[model samples]
Target: MNLSVNVQEEQGTAVVYLAGEVDVYTAPALKETLLPLTEQSSTTVIVNLSDVTYIDSTGLGIFIGALKSSGKAGSKLKITGANVRVKRLFTITGLNEVLDIEEDQREEV
Candidate 1:
């Protein structure tokens, strides 16, 4: 699986732009990429999946883990630009209820 992440720091937020598959083979990379940002700044983490093409359970776990870490640090973690398939994964896993997800401007849970 190939994954690419571009992180941009702005004021009080880190915008992470993700692309490619986020699965067991790549989830760890995702975690590692975000860890430094989480530790270095007290800013809201925004994961933008507009360019992401695919994701699996392991990827979901990474997001959940990031959320947990951000919560512990009193920072916010949000997911945005999820496509229909990714949105379905979140819904089926009940992750939509636990995380702040926004698609095209409409907020879900």
Candidate 2:
């Protein structure tokens, strides 16, 4: 599946909404969008993955890089809206404690 990223300015944070699969082919796009945001001040980056279908190691690595980059500049990068399967991946990889991840809960229809 194709990856789609939509970026919006939320309060003082830059929120990136992601959908579809994030793998080797699509990681660059995300990187391009995030790296620049990490370089600045006065804003944090919040990556919202509610609609993301899948994410490979490369994608995870990109997040790590963003975290580091933002940290160097005294900013923060956060993640939210991850499903159980994705949350499991983060836990198994020991990134659950390292990264700020928010569980996604949807209202029943």
- The prediction achieving the highest lDDT against the true structure is 2
| lDDT at position 35, candidate 1 | 68
Question: Please, what are the lDDT tens digits per residue for candidate 2 over residues 13-108?
Answer: 999999998899999999999989887776788999999878999998998898888878877788998876777788989998888887677752
For model 1, the superposed segments whose C-alpha errors exceed 4 Å read 105-109
Where's the lowest-lDDT run of ten residues in candidate 2?
Answer: 100-109
Model 1 per-residue lDDT tens digits across residues 25-62? 98998999886666554788889998787899999999
For candidate 2, report its TM-score: 0.91
- Candidate 2, clashing residue pairs? none
Residue pairs with colliding backbones in model 1 are: none
lDDT of each: 0.85, 0.86
